[model samples]
Target chain A: MNSVAGTGLARAVGRLRGSGRSAIGRWFVIAVPYFWLALFFLVPFLIVLKIAFSNIQLSMPPVEPIVTWAGDKVFQLRLHFSNFTFVFGDDLYRAAFLNSLQVAGISTLFALLIGYPMAYGIARAPGTWRNILFLLVVLPFFTSFLLRVYAWMGLLGRNGPINGVLLKLGIVAEPLQLLQTDFAVYLGMVYSYLPFMVLPLYTAIEKLDLTLLEAAADLGCRPTKAFFKITLPLTKEGVFAGCLLVFIPAVGEYVIPALLGGPDTLMIGRVVWDEFFGNRDWPVASALAIVLLVILAGFVLLLQKVQAREKEAA
Target chain B: MTGRRSFFVLSAMVFGFAFLYLPILSMIVYSFNASRLVTVWDSAHSPTLAWYVELFHNDQVLDAARLSFRIAAVNATGAVILGTLAAFALERYTRFRGRTLFGLLTTAPMVLPEVITGLSLLLLFVALDQAVGWPSGRDATTITIAHMTFSLAYVVVVVQSRLATVDRSLEEAAMDLGARPWKVFFVITLPLIAPAIASGWVLAFILSWDDIVITSFVSGPGSTTLPQLVFSKVRLGVSPDINALATILVLIVSVGVAILGVYMMRRDRRRARDAQAAFAVIP
Candidate 1:
């Protein structure tokens, strides 16, 4: 749907068409949101970058200015590499970064494995059923995320039903410690973000031109091969969108880790949270955040470039 | 289509829905538990609503709900306006300079971690208060702004997707009929995209209502929201009161969404019938 860069002729047409009756109205459409985002979103990241470069201090704001007027009109910039150095050098921070990547990657994989079939099913279902199934998938999202995670705690707890059934059926000698484990954290992530994975996949699959698949079948392609050749390639956008939607935020997810994860499952999100609120180390926290942002930014750019290349090829 | 619903797909649907809902069902059951311990089945007493009664009287929760309701309403309204503008710009102003950067800025909040967004925004507020003395002190206003910023991204995503799918030819027809650009939008495009705008507003409101991560950082003294209160209560362990709260929220949302879903389905059917009647297709 995002053509990215249209033909020059098309772009000109778009530009000409965009000129409404009044120029002020056209400008207002773009300017209001443009200024709002630049102020609220872009400016905050710049502030984070500025804070990351400054030394930690004990104050209300908790960081000194990176650039200050020193002496008489001689501007001095004080930059500190200590925060970045400490964050990168520390084993704790290092482990958290690695763990966050590993956990998020694996969770995205599971979410895909589960979400793909469900999305395909829903998208391909009969018309009335399709609407109902889509609503079912999204209904949980209206509920509180925190409570939903909390629901996992109850369902997987020692005294919860999973254990209750297993123990009652004499499947185990004792109740398993399900809560506050890596298993719980992964379960929480997959459960919470499953809708994110399913929604896009459903949209993409629903948009699939079935004639292509029928044409492939008429050409003697097997059902499985037809799916792999036509459906998979055509739905790449949805897959990419779904994976990005799941993976990016999952890396910096604090609630799941803090609630469901064990001490060993130290994600970068929790580390940043602890540094800021626990130790009151704003500089280190900002530095950690910047490092995480850089990693995420790289991933985003690479994914988009790869997708664009594919789009161009097709 | 019937043949398409293979056993594999059916099982996936069953298992997926089961996995999604069993925990919620457990919460509902526990909320009615006659026992204080959430995980335990006070089969004798849990079939009671004592916890629900207790919470309805709790002033802290009630006050937090009131404040959160106000913030969510404000955030939703502001976010819808901003998001509609952003979405229209992205879809219609296809050749604007720096459109890529504008898209990135709008979508980045959706991709960025709440911790980072919260921290960066909190830092911005701190810096602003210190430098300009505008916010003076972090409070509901700051929290509302934070919610607006974060939720607007969702609104943009929702509204933009809908806008991209809208038939521009309808607007063009209006324009050709002596309608101005704004008038064309108001008469044609807005009605077509009303559902998307409504969903976007609901989503923004829900995001604000359920937020704890960002709200924790931006909110100041005496500005605790419902989710924050729930988090503190649930962090220790399972509690029946929280379970009851979950039950109530789920019930309210289920009722609201079900009604909305049915109403939409009925509306669509009626429209289809009207179209058929206009053409005298059946006769």
Candidate 2:
């Protein structure tokens, strides 16, 4: 089936290149999406980069253009490295960057710790139950993400259910300060992104050959040892994929930290928001965003390289 | 040992699912609270549908929901069309010039932070509006366009994966029988991958509907989406009306997903049976 498809696709490609009308059709298919993405996605990034080098102004658009035209001729060109330098030199921006990394990294770790077990359990369940379990995992994902976070707010507020339960059980003298803190932020992150982690992990673990574990057990290996030596190593790609899925967005998560986090909880996402909207500093916001894009792009490239190597190895 | 392992697995599953569903469950419960305060539950008062009533009547909420639905519907359709084309180009063509760049452009949005994407797009709109008198100001068009950009990435990934697993012989056999390439795609490939496209549409729709960050960034005065409205409201404080709205959204989404799931499951069963019957004939 696969080989036939390969050859068929190859032949189609050949015909596409050789024939004029079909070639135009193929080009049209490619060109439409290509142009849309180039204009909307790629050009926007360049615009961001360009704006990052411009100086903030109190004018209509709130930024001084890097290039100016006087009567269709070049008037003057001014590029500001000040925005980049300011972001680098400021402790506020630096702390926000570090804090975002820390929050995202910790939340991702917790998600993995929780998600791995659930995914493994789902994979090992009776075949009929596996689909239902997978559905349940994804069901929450379809619900509004903002609503889910709001649900968290209700559950963790000072007068909320968690505090009520804790107070009733005499766990503490007073209601625990669960809301508007890093703890709440982390909880929100883990809750919201857990599905992201589990979906990939379940896909990986479900595809595992159980007979390999049986073989190890027949060879007198303990279940724990067999799991460590066999299952974990095999599902490493899922772990990586799940981690990347959670970590990338969590790093720039604004809603969670804004709603759940205290004033002290500084994430680069919220910082960028304030810079753009609150402070009306488009250039600085653009600068901060460019820095984030650079980091994420590097990580994405690295992930792609790793996946390619794995494909080659396979 | 087996008993112990099963126990562990069972316990983990219970705890994990509880953690996942409890917040949503609580929200649903509290949405019924007769009191205005969301966190307070008093048995003295009877549970009321007052908040739901208010939710139906609120012009702001109703308007926002209407706008969000319109944008999501349009964005989902656009994303699916653009995404399927991109997916086909990548999977079938395989060696087009600048394919690497095309691949990156389509896929990067999948993982790019919403903050960055939103900020960059907003900047682009502002720049473009200034440079050329187009997109005059941020509105539903801009929001839909931004939503489509990110949603397109997701649709591409979903459709491309399905395309990867599709049997090539189906198209090949059709071509051998003298079907045009376009006819083969529409009659053969399209029907085969129809399930993927359907799910892609749903995913895009949901993503666009639930998006707050990007919409908030690009939306001008009259283009606030439901999520953006909810976010702003929740930020100020939780209102029972928002809870009622959330409950309704949950119900709608749950029903939608359940329908899709059952449909997919039935289709899978029929496909599997057909495949088995075909194999039996060959034998």
Candidate 3:
């Protein structure tokens, strides 16, 4: 009876899989989001690219339209590469971009150093405890992002708990310059993005085969050695994924640097925000954004290629 | 098994959690301080709920909260419908023309910097309004749409993962038994993936609610979301009432997440039992 039922299930699945109507279903699933995104997500980049070239004018929208319908059959196209030149030429823009890259890279390193063991611990924990631990990791994520950053302000303030502890413990006589510094910015970045690092690593570590480690152990390999050989290579993708997750957001992180860092700390996200709102340089801001997108898109495509290669090798 | 939980790893877990929760716990503690200044503690009238009362009475906060809630709700619903469709396409229909572009669209938002997305989207809206007289202004309508675009990517991530794990044989079996593709999806696939969809909804809602960057660009005057309002207020310095607001938000989220977690675990166990029973009858 069981054999017959299994055959029936297989036959049913096969027939449905081959059905022509399923093709319509497939298209229905694909077309809706495809159209929605093509209009909303993809087309916006085209507009950004267009606006990046057009001259900024004191109009209501703050930029002249790129394509103007000059008298019949003569549509004038204005392409000013000055915005790109200005973004590239400005020392401030270059500094902010490089600083952002540096800050994000270092923060990604810190998060990985902190997140990997926590993820491994949680992934290896006993069943019920694992879920509870996972929930605990995710709990803060459900709360207000701004408030958590605000919390850091309180904690790192001269009059806050950290200072109080330092003074009471006789560690220092005066309050440290904790807030409005690069240290505070990095700390906030690591804290905000640690969960993003941990989650992917946890998923990867959880799927790791234990028997391989056991086999290595039986062959008289040290635990650390076995881990280095069997585990590290296997979870490299997760680490890379986690690093990307942290790095991308951290590079463009505005709230952390704005709330936590002082005047000297420069980030490109802040630069873009200032140019668009403060300076009212729409074209330059659009140009900055376009460059940022190109760089990020390059990284993403590179990751995709590497992952595809890994899959093929596997 | 014994080697799995090393002293180093266990300590790391403890330390990691401490780093995560200490900021929040301090925030909650400071919210109740009697002093007007958030950083200072007044020993005489400590642990007052004065700020909570102030939060309730603040008209700006109340209005902004209402706006954020409205936008988040609308965004969540729109994102789920679009996200589910996208997830079904990516997971079930693996091979198709433009599949690469479709996948890129679905995932790119997750990694795209908000400033770029916001700037580009604002430009798109401006050009669209200029070309066609529809969506004549940037307001809650535009903010909600912007939120949906980003938040749907998250919804897709969640729902697509769930879809990948779902037992496809059940869906195919129903289709083979003469149920229409749409009907099979509605009746069978939907139930199986409902938890993911629900979580996706909640995630989308929170992301939209918590967003400041995108909303700052897209939202016009008088359409201030709670985060934007709070951001503008707190950009200068900290305040006691914002702490009160934070504490309240954390409490609400904790309760909601706890309930969802427990419910999902129970459902999973019950489903496991049902599967066992069904297989027993088959044998």
Candidate 4:
């Protein structure tokens, strides 16, 4: 009777442990990512949303966090639209936004111009040299970005190398006034972002079927015609991908302009910086940030729709 | 295919390489240029080692370099772990309703403009302080957090691609042989994907090392990075010491990539020779 009782107890313990292990396994697969992204990524965005609506008066230390309503009605928090109004109220912010769009758009276009053919060249190069070419394209990115931009300062400044070289070569009797100009800013932007454009384009173009080009050639398409009709159409996905990669980030760029641009190159990013650090206007900065986010989100949605369409067509 | 086409392509390729390398090569060569001005091209200038020596003695630059390395090391390791986990869960788990959205979230940090990411992170820090009174400040800790958030996205992409190509049957075969899922994953999946992990780690490290925008916004006082230091210095006055630093960076990166290339080339040649010998035997 005691042996029978012992066997029963063992069976029960074994079953309990097995269930526990399986439960732990199931929970592990779900809980880890959920809590992590929530705490770090998703929650941070939510916090931004909350603070954007919160009054600065309630945000002080000791952290009681009171809120006010119209006609002295009290609440714990209130959503305010005044911050958005304040951002749009000023011409400076509006100009900054427009300038940012123009710079990012133009620079992205230029980057594509240089990067697309370069990516094609690298993709079509002998297999032995392909990795080296790709590595070269990306090597500049591994260095100090600020320093690289700073290096351009030496190359573009009034007394810098470019001007000095030009003077010696007798191309210009005097400095061409390249520094602090839109041309300099665009140069810096394209130089920094060109790699981004090339990589995606390279990946996309490398996957192209050589037979397609052959097929076009056999169908009486000239070499240039083959490239334009077959190669370019097939590579459109990559082209758009590279453009988005370059354009999205360029839209919010502040550093290139900050380092190379003159007063005329007032980007929204710099405006955001000035609002937060220079002016200590947290609410206004948050509002501008939201505006930027909304714009970016729209762009992203458009990109997604385009990608989905491409995938379907493929 | 045509001679004309080949000529055009080759010339374009040459110009591309030249355009990319000239400024960098000039920076490297001019680092040793004896003249203070970087432009003048005369052998009589007698290349000197003065700037490199000066760079070693510059306390500010040295401190900033040390700090940058330390932060990058920590950020890269943290990102690899978090990113690998997230990628594993997304890839191995059954497809869910919100999988697309979750995938988008993982990549969103990367796609969004750096200015927005950095600014939003700053705002998040302030909100956290007000809400919980913890992380009541921003410092290297905040900087590391910001770096990891973005770097993790990169690691996930690298690992996810590798995972996608993996033969799921291998893991299923292990399970059929009586290994538990966890044991199979640990013993089989991790070992098979080790190369991906290594590549991801290297890529993450490079990203953190080169980061400036996010670091600029979130880094605390006295936490000035190498790039930030160079930025400030250049803004004040262009210095040849910076050129020396740039030259050193280029050399290190070039050497690293060259070694990787050499190893890959040797491996490819061996594999090709083995294939040819096998074909000879078949014939």
Candidate 5:
């Protein structure tokens, strides 16, 4: 009896030590991720904001201003909101911003239309085949993204295989000018982002109970009606999440437009790139960066609201 | 059974895969084409391995390829280590406050636009140079750091999921048997999460390998990575050499994937066999 009590006491002490160790470990965990983000992410945004509000004379340090503000004394180093006007006032910048929105909007729509069916198919696939389907969907991302786009270039080039085959088959009298166009930009963006759209949708669809669909079916709904009433509603979270994932990045995609888009297809990301590297306008670039962050932040809040509503509805 | 639904699904699946794969397939086939023009085929003309041969001999391509591989290896290793530790700290401890905030913070880098990420990294580099004179200018070191910044998020998620499923009793039993904390972790926990770490490493490597956006921001004149090289080339014009280079990259990646798949299959079989042995030994 005494030995058993001793064992119990030892166990209790062990539990106490474990809990104490875990408490310390937890703080370490919390600190590490927090520190990383603060140093890298939050600090970067803060830096962008600071730069956005500062004067951008080439010789002046990007961070510091020549003058300091003291109450009524206007300082060169002080915050300026003119950068916003610079962005909004420029007809080119406004056009690029609007073009970015349209391209992202359309590409996201196409990705959803294409990816939804693929995700649904994967979710409904046999368990043994599900992984293979998932891998197939994911495989394109593993390859060099540049090369993938280049491959599309090869296919879409006026004199490339797509045109050659079409001409040979007598489908069209002239070769389609597919490359270096807005159409090519849309194709590249949608293709590259399709996997991102599908994966999230798959996860959401996979979690859905088949009984709900069956119940809808048993309640005198046709297959299409049942899908609209049950399946679509059930996977709305994934659709929203996937759309957000695709749209946000697509809005900021510079590479696709830089390679595949025409001169007419100016995007905000490409414009920002030009500001920093080409234009050497650091303050304007920083202002653009700040605008992007605010927009993204808004988008994320919208996502969160949708997610919360989804949870409450559930 | 909805026949129409099944047919529509099947048609979509096949066409989608075809669209995804056909361009890749053509690229591979054209890599062996003897002619300079990739589109037109001359059946009578003999196929040559000259493009692959030229790919190995091209000085610029070789240098870029070497630089890319070195950066990827370094980033992958660093990300796996740092990310696995973060995962361990998150999973093994429960007393941490604001875990959800930490989780969101960790994932922020993943969702940030490449344009912004590159711009931020460039800004950080400028600030660091003015402050400490380290990473004197944008170079390979900066590139690797940028790659790790984003890739580490994915590694942590993969590792954390695996860690969450681990049975804690095993670690407790090891500690109860008088093992040190580190000893218990090494002996009881490390093996359990090894697969996750391996997967994470491979994923990180791929991300680092394929990264062009952030790398483009920080790469110096001569330090362009392979993807950056390809991007510059594609922007200028499509050359047959670029196609050759792409084919070789595809070959390497495809082989790596096949090897990983085979290894996973063999490991699964070995695990099944081991389980069978355990069952057979049971009374």
Candidate 6:
């Protein structure tokens, strides 16, 4: 009886596997998300590219057509390269782009500086307390990101708590202009994005083998020297990942700058926002977005190449 | 040397946590301040619950919060369904056509800047409206679609990584017991990955709820989300009412996180016990 049942089960399993491996099943599974992304993600990018080459118009859709159907013998194609030319030629756009990179780069550095120590401390802490400490790091991440930025406004405002405390301590005669300045912007960026830096760093540091550090120590290597030689190299990937995560988003950050930055602080993201909503220049906005996209894609491709090289070396 | 190193580690942890949490703690405290001026603390007035009462009564706040919740709920559900399908395709079928493109689509949005995503989607909607006249205007539907597009990437990342670690033999064995492929998936695979799916749903929900940038671009008049409302108000200056709202959000998120942590702890203990029992049987 047992042998008979086993044979029946084997037959059923074989038939099921045969059916599951069918092309229809595979296609059905793959097509859903693929089609959605094509429709939403890929198609939108194509539209943006098309619009970037079109002239701005004060019409319903707000951009002149790049292509139009004329008589059967003659089809008209009008493409405006001026939008790109204007973005490149104008110093305002150029400065905004450069300022964005500078601010994001500095903010990434600050985030790393503050986040590395915190991640390292958590990784090396007592095992039982590690989870709780990690939770503390991630809790604020799940909270409202806007509210967190708003909290900074309250803290940095002239009559806010930070200023109040400083005034009481005679740190300054008056409330220093902490709000609507570059300092406030950097502080907000670092505060908001520190978790993105810490989580990846902690993942790398936690997986680090202690025996290697011990071996270094036994060889009379100083702790800081061991960290530099052994730990840093091993955690290089995590550092890169964390930096990209913070820097990419920080570059295009709209909220932190708009809320905290003064008019002098010009980021590409704010410029794009102003172009689309304030000026209603869809062509210019699309051009700015495309340029930003190209820069980010270049950064991503470079990181991939570096990663591939590292893999080959290993 | 060890003592000094540990002292440094301890101090770093304290200072880091202080920086992370001090702003939030101040916001929560100021919510109850009686003074209308948020930055000032008048000793004569002291703490009060007036803002909380007013927050509950503010029709604009209530309506915006409702719209935000509805959109987030719909987007979270839609994203999970779409994301799970993508995860299964990437995890289970490796040699499909256009696999590389699918993989790129799955992950690209994870790092794509929100400004670009929002702008592109808004443009897409506008173009679609012009060509097809389907979605005539930006509204809750458009906002939900935009949220799902980006949030789907996060859900896929989470679920796909979990699927990578899931054992395959269980499904094979279920099929061996005369279960069909779909039956095996529903009975064995889904249950095994249910935790990951639940966390993905929660993440999608929070992400959708917290969205302001994308929603701002996609949302039309009368479809304002809570974050947009709060942001517009916050731009003027910090209000005690917003502080009240922030405090409530912090409370709700804390409770949700606490529950998830407890569930995870229990699950870990159960797995440990099961492993021990299996080892005993082997012995």
Candidate 4, TM-score of its B chain: 0.95
Task: Enumerate residue pairs that collide in model 1.
Answer: B32-B46, B33-B46, B34-B45, B34-B46
Q: What DockQ does each listed candidate score? A: 0.62, 0.74, 0.59, 0.52, 0.49, 0.75
Error of 5 at A99 (Å): 1.7
For candidate 3, the docking band is: medium
> Residue-wise lDDT of candidate 4 within A153-219, one digit each (tens)?
7777777678887888999988877767788788888888888899999998999999988887888
lDDT of 6 by residue, B1-283 (tens): 7688778878877888999999999999999888999979867877888899999999999999999999999999999999999999999998977899889998988888888999999999999999999699989999999999999999999899999988999988887787866778789888888988988999999999999988999999969999999999999988999999999999999888777677666777788899999999995
Q: How high is the CA lDDT of each candidate model?
A: 0.90, 0.92, 0.91, 0.80, 0.83, 0.91
The per-residue C-alpha lDDT of model 2 at residue B55 equals: 90
* Predicted structure with the largest TM-score when compared to the true one: 6
- Measured by TM-score, how close is model 4 to the native structure? 0.91
What residue pairs clash in candidate 2, if any at all?
A5-B168
**Span of 10 residues, lowest total lDDT, candidate 3 chain A:** A16-25
- Of the pair 1 and 6, which is ahead by DockQ? 6
Q: Best to worst by lDDT, what's the order?
A: 2, 6, 3, 1, 5, 4
lDDT of 3 by residue, A11-122 (tens): 7887877676778777787998999899889999988898899889998789888789999899998899999999999999899989999999999999999999999999
lDDT of 5 by residue, A192-302 (tens): 889889999999999999998788788878999888888998889899989989999898898889888987789999989998888788889888877876888888898
Writing each residue's lDDT as its tens digit, candidate 3 over B94-128 gives 79999999999999898999998898889889888
Stretches of candidate 4 exceeding 4 Å from the true structure:
A1-23, A54-76, A310-314, B35-46, B96-101
Worst 10 residues of 2 chain A by lDDT: A14-23
Fnat (0 to 1) per candidate? 0.81, 0.83, 0.80, 0.45, 0.49, 0.78
* TM agreement with the true structure for every prediction: 0.91, 0.93, 0.91, 0.91, 0.89, 0.95
B-chain TM-score, every candidate? 0.89, 0.92, 0.90, 0.95, 0.89, 0.94
List model 2 lDDT by residue over A1-314, tens digit each.
Answer: 99999999998987766476678879999999999999999999898888899988889799888888866666877789999999999999999999999999999999999999999999988754776788899999999899999999899988898999989999888989888999999999999999999999999999999999999999999999998999998998999999999999999999999999998899999999999999999999999999998887788789879988987887
Interface RMSD of each: 2.6, 1.4, 2.5, 2.4, 2.4, 1.1
In model 5, state the lDDT of residue A146: 81
Q: What is the TM-score of chain A in candidate 6?
A: 0.93
